[model samples]
Target: MKASHDLSGLVKFLSRDDWAFHFEEVMGDHFWPVMDHFDLDHEEINDALGDHWAMTLWGCAFEDFLTQVFDPGGQTFVEAYLKRRSWKESAQSKAYMTALGTSVMSLYEASEIVPGKSFLARDLIRGGEPVLISEGTATKTLRQWERVAARIVPLGGKLIIAGGLLPFSQEASDALLEGFKALPGKRRRSRTQPLLDDEMLRAAAPLFTHAFLFDVLPKALGETRPIIHNSDGDEIVFHEVRFPLATGITRKDIAWRLQGIPQLRQENAQFWNWLDERSQKGPLKARVPNALAAGTTMEDGTPVLGNLELKGRFLTLMVNSAARAARGREMLENVLGKMVGVPLTTIQTIEQMQEARKGRTKEVDDIPLEVATPLVHAMLDKQYREILDQPVGMLGDISPRSAVGTQKGREKVAEWLKYLEFRSASSQNPHDPMTTYDFGWMWRELNIENLRR
Candidate 1:
């Protein structure tokens, strides 16, 4: 479906402002209580970048060109933002329901979810009686045990209620069996079930536990797609992936190196080559899009003779976990090349931030500068940090407790994975998305020369 909103004028209008302020304003108005969940306040948002307009200058041109030139058919911010909201709300509700059931089930028999109170161990049902289920399967079984135990207790008999993960915990199970055997009764009829098959209990047997239900089972049922905001005024669907964010070169490191070597800029190509060689020897984990460049080839079956620059506006990066966030700085250390312009131009001062928060005394903390690193590493770290902390529909900003109760909860448990994919509605390098063309005709000569040669 096509979007009805006009993004061209909007894009032009936004481009004129300091990109950082625009982003901060957009996030502040739209992210809401969701942003609060991550402990990020308005002042912090304003302080995130040293150069508010850096991302705008570096990332915008490609996006603008993509909408205005390459692909005339475009979408808008309003539609995209609304779609993301819907996805987030739906996912949150689903997660909450599932987690509630699982949590209650875990404590079943020994204790129950008492509408508003905590579980009571003394009210367990143990004998044969008609069962009534008010809410859950465990509650029904508990009712049956209660009735049976009452009838048998008078005749010096016993009863046992079952259901819930309590029966599986070594401590709870042992305590239950001991209690059952020691119950006061002339003819005690303890609740019992057939033991697990010998084969099922073998050391090597693949065991399935309820934690698996809360942790791994949901993905098998298809709840991994998350709603993520994109630059082209839209939200994109993404399959979650986890990765470590710790460790990386960093933007400041690059800046320091570049600044230290005054002659580095005199030979940009040579400097890049030397850096690339060191990176090959450096102890760093290569990531997606960045890694994609190492093997990219041209349409005519020829590998292009150029370095891959993971730049531009319309890039959707899936930062699935904290590891990616922590290491993001190092990844961008002098290697990432450049970022979109809007984010870069939005840099703000402590004074501006204080002015913005004039009414709210609590938000007057001075804006802290982002850790400076090389352009590439800083950008990588920034993207990783943003995704690490940004409130995506499924995993980024939802309450940990809320997530555990639904599909989103299950996805959160898989935060150790590190798979990322890049999708773009607009790009300068259609053939090589990792890079962008700052000067439209700049690469044409290189291609023509390669052909002639």
Candidate 2:
């Protein structure tokens, strides 16, 4: 299939790998080399760069560049192209253009400009300026431009539109659109698939069984500060409450909400000490470095630490946004297949449910385990709530970036799908029952206790 149309699968397929992914080729005729005549240092030349620089060099963002290039413009394709570049570079109020203009022009002809500088050539033909790509014959960094371009464009509101060259045989654009279209529906109407097929009790066959519990996990128990009891006469301590009854009960659901939990900054020395102990065991693998570990020291120069310092209990606030469903699903599959430690489908389902619940209407069927999942699932979905934004943070504050994606938050739909897969696959069974590896104490913590609280 054309690379442009194959974007859906390509994105999903690529996400299974590390953070850095290459999409320059997938861009096809849509992109052109921006540095055809630049005098860049070897290091900058060798690194991956995003096409955004090219766009910026042309005096517009990626999308702006596209509209201008594809739509009718006066000058000869070359003149218009150079005109745009001059404008783009000048807007930056820098000498990047004048300093490298001549070099950029000469490189496009597939001829060397400066001995050790670089060269570039147009590959794909779309509208006016042929899409310049790395001919590889040049000594400069070809890929770096694309890499930088990718980061800047997406982070901004504009989408890095690409069409044509697909790695596989597919209408990459259509597939991408299909996935994009599906994002909202999935977010609005969560897709809940069964975790297992019922099997009769046998001498030895795996069967699924789930347990539910509810409790208030006080910060003090973990060697942190105590929660402040409100003026109400209700209890401050979180007792081991029963199921179903506990399922819907969030901190907000409680009659007299537990109050006065100290902010992480106020966390007493005990918290820091706990972090130290946990750090000594090993790297204390975490999403971010352990700050507490760096703060405190032990009696014999020994350390104390609370293995995983939680920032806050997961938040489940309703949000209004747009998403691409196909992308969400592909993201789920990639995450699951790559992060073997976690399940995929479950999280997706949970995200779908949460998005649906945010709306006034109910769209999808309820899974048998709906009541069993934590209340957070009703809002943020499992994958996003737990994985993307770790249930654990510094001690009551989530990172600013953990919120939105299309804007600046985590992709909620993808996260929920992952969570669903995690919860479902981890359910206990009769013969081959679930173990800590599948449903560990932490899982239990997610389901029952007042974690974020």
Candidate 3:
């Protein structure tokens, strides 16, 4: 179905000033409260390169583009829903329901969701008590999950919404998407609102590419297609594979297990290469996506291993086809369970493991980031020093200060600045999103690329 909204004119009216104010004023009006309620720490919404407003910049400009272009479409579902439902008496309620008409709302927008709290976690009933769904199964539960923009994109059928990657995290969003995917197919719920059709989405995709939202939603989501298809229309199917760790096995134990397997060994090598590239700092991040890896444990007892990016004991795999995913799972089972003597535990899909992790006790081990990470109230200053700027002697024996002297030093300094910017940019820390990191000093000192207003 065609969008009744005039998306073409969406960008026509949005000038740099509109965006500067949107993130600073409009978004801040809606965004900050949500962050506070969820205990999500953020300094504030800012346009670092406010002076550079060419129609040509890449990362920052595209981010602003999403801030503007996605407003109408993101509001489509809830706006239509509000039309069908009875209007509430409270003026505040009226504003909450109607707000989606122009802005993308998220968990942060939860408080003013009018009649219903839009930020509350809703569930999809897949036979028993509400289960966390698989990748693309059930986009948004009519009752459980509330952020329409967050849930819809992954279901391959859920309605489109205004929010993009900025407010919510990419990984948590992906996990939610997978939960929707894992829902039993026969009982899947039809979308609450009409989906923006291929024609509309095709027109919409460029807005994403130009806005750089594409960095979050890639063309090939494993083997799955976006519920809203893009024009590039690459016809491929991706499957998520998982091998659950035994009760006692740690992610650190994987190296010993893979000591003899040539294929997995090769795969492990490729994963690190991708991690190294992902960890590199620079403007544009000049990086591909972070390679998802499954490590049992590190030999050194290092709490952090191979980049500190593992998702606990569960090693999830992403392959193109179900057949390949199945085969890979079988191979891992044979290699890990039968040959290597890592005692074959019960085999389950990543979604199944995730679904089950829902009910475990606090003492029981559960998904690292999901069940536990939210409670972490570590000092921002400490994490900033530990994770972002720990220590690197790239210029022999000099700080970023001394390096700015020579041409080679300046180039190295640029890399350091870019690394800081890129890391803070791509960081998905739910507690401390990259936005919370204050890179204002470096931005001024480096005199890097000027950002669009």
On the 0 to 100 scale, the lDDT of residue 387 in model 2 is 43
Worst 10 residues of 3 by lDDT: 296-305
Clashes per candidate (backbone, < 3 Å): 61, 82, 39
lDDT of 2 by residue, 127-239 (tens): 12322232222333222111111111111222221221111111222222233334322222222421111111110010000000001111112334432221121112221
Q: Which stretches of candidate 2 lie over 4 Å from their true place?
A: 1-276, 280-369, 374-453
- Per-residue error for 229 in candidate 1, Å, reads 24
Q: Write the per-residue lDDT of candidate 1 for residues 1-453, one digit (tens) a residue.
A: 212212333334444325334444433333344235435553443344224322322222222222121112233332233333334334433332222212211112322233322222332223232222233333433321111111001111212221112223222333334433453442344445212222222211111121222222223333353222222112222222222222354434434444443212222311221122112221122232112122222111122111211122221122222333223333433333443211111223334555777877544564322322244344544544444333333243443233444654544422211112111102343333222212112113212211110
Best-performing candidate as measured by lDDT: 3
Query: Could you arrange the candidates by lDDT from highest to lowest?
Result: 3, 1, 2
Cα lDDT for residue 338, candidate 1 = 46
Q: What is the TM-score of each candidate against the true structure?
A: 0.14, 0.16, 0.25
Best by TM-score: 3
lDDT of 3 by residue, 140-170 (tens): 2221112223222222222333323232233
Q: Which stretches of candidate 3 lie over 4 Å from their true place?
A: 1-238, 244-252, 255-315, 318-405, 415-432, 440-453
- Distance from true location, Cα of 29 in model 2, Å: 20
Query: Residue 160 deviation, candidate 3, in Å?
Result: 37
lDDT for 31 in candidate 1 is 32
Off by over 4 Å in 1: 1-312, 316-326, 332-335, 338-453
